[model samples]
Target: MGFSVAYETAELISPALQREMIAVTNELSSDRAWLSCEPPLLMNRGGILGGASKPNFSPHPDELAAAKAAGERDGTLSDLIQILCSVSSQFDVDWVISHDCSNGPLGCIRCGRCDPEVQDQCQVLSELAEELGGCDLDLDDL
Candidate 1:
C-alpha cells in the first residue's frame, strides 16, 4: 500500500484498539496468548513503520550511528558527507547573505537581494531548504 494509506491504517489501529482487541479476545476465548504478547512488540509500534510510537519519529541515534559507521566502512559516508557539507554550507551562506541584504526581515522590499537576476536563485535555495526538512535555525541563530 501507499505510504499515506499505510500510515492512516496504522493510525486507526492505535494502542487503544490493540488493548481492546486483546481484552475482547480473552473474554471470548480461553486462549491467553494475547495477554502475553505485548501490543507494541507484536505490532512493531514505534518503529520505522510508524505508529502510536514515540513523540519523535526520527530514527534512533544508535541506528543512525551504526548506519553511518557502516557507510564509512564502505567509503560511501565520506563522499556523502562531503557533498552534504558542501551543499549545506552553500545554503547557509546564501540564506545569511540574503537575509543580511534584505535588511531586518521586512523582506526584499526592492533591495538588491530581490534583484531579478538573483531572485530565482534565492527562491530555488529556499525551496531546497524546505525540501531538506524544517530548519530549527532562526534568524537570531544565523
Candidate 2:
C-alpha cells in the first residue's frame, strides 16, 4: 500500500508571535501544524495590523460623503447600525467588527443622531447612503 497527502497550507506569522500562533493552530487542527514566520509587512519596515493605510478618498467619494453626512447627523456607525438593528430583530444581534487593515474593515464609529428607540432599519441606511461624503467607507459603492 502507498500513502499520499492531498494538500499543504501555511499561515503568515510575526517572528515574535510565531510560537503563540503555532500553539493556537495546533489547538485547532490535529493534522495541520503551525510554522514560524515573520509577519508580512506590505509597505513600510513596520508590521501589519498595527500599521495604517491611506484611505482612498477618490474611489468612494459618494459613499464617503454619505457616511460623513450621516456621521455628522448621527455618527459613522449610524447607517450600518440601523441596518443591523432591524435585521437583528429575530435574534440577539451584536455588531461584529472584522478588523483587517489590509482589507479596510471597520469597527463602530459613533454619532449624535443614534437613537435606541427607532425600529426602522432601512431608513437608517437610506439616509446614510444619501449623506455619504468623499470617503464614506462603511456604505456600498455610490
Give the winner by TM-score.
2
Score every model by TM-score.
0.17, 0.20
Error of 2 at 117 (Å): 20
Clashes of each: 0, 18
For 64-95, candidate 1 gives per-residue lDDT tens digits of: 46645655221111222222223224322111
lDDT of 2: 0.28
Instruction: Please estimate how well model 1 matches the true structure, expressed as its whole-model Cα lDDT.
Output: 0.28
**Model 2: lDDT of residue 116:** 36
As a whole number from 0 to 100, the lDDT of residue 31 in candidate 1 is 22
Which residue runs of candidate 1 sit more than 4 Å off their true CA positions?
1-113, 134-142
Error of 1 at 8 (Å): 50
- Which stretches in model 2 have alpha-carbon errors above 4 Å? 1-77, 102-142
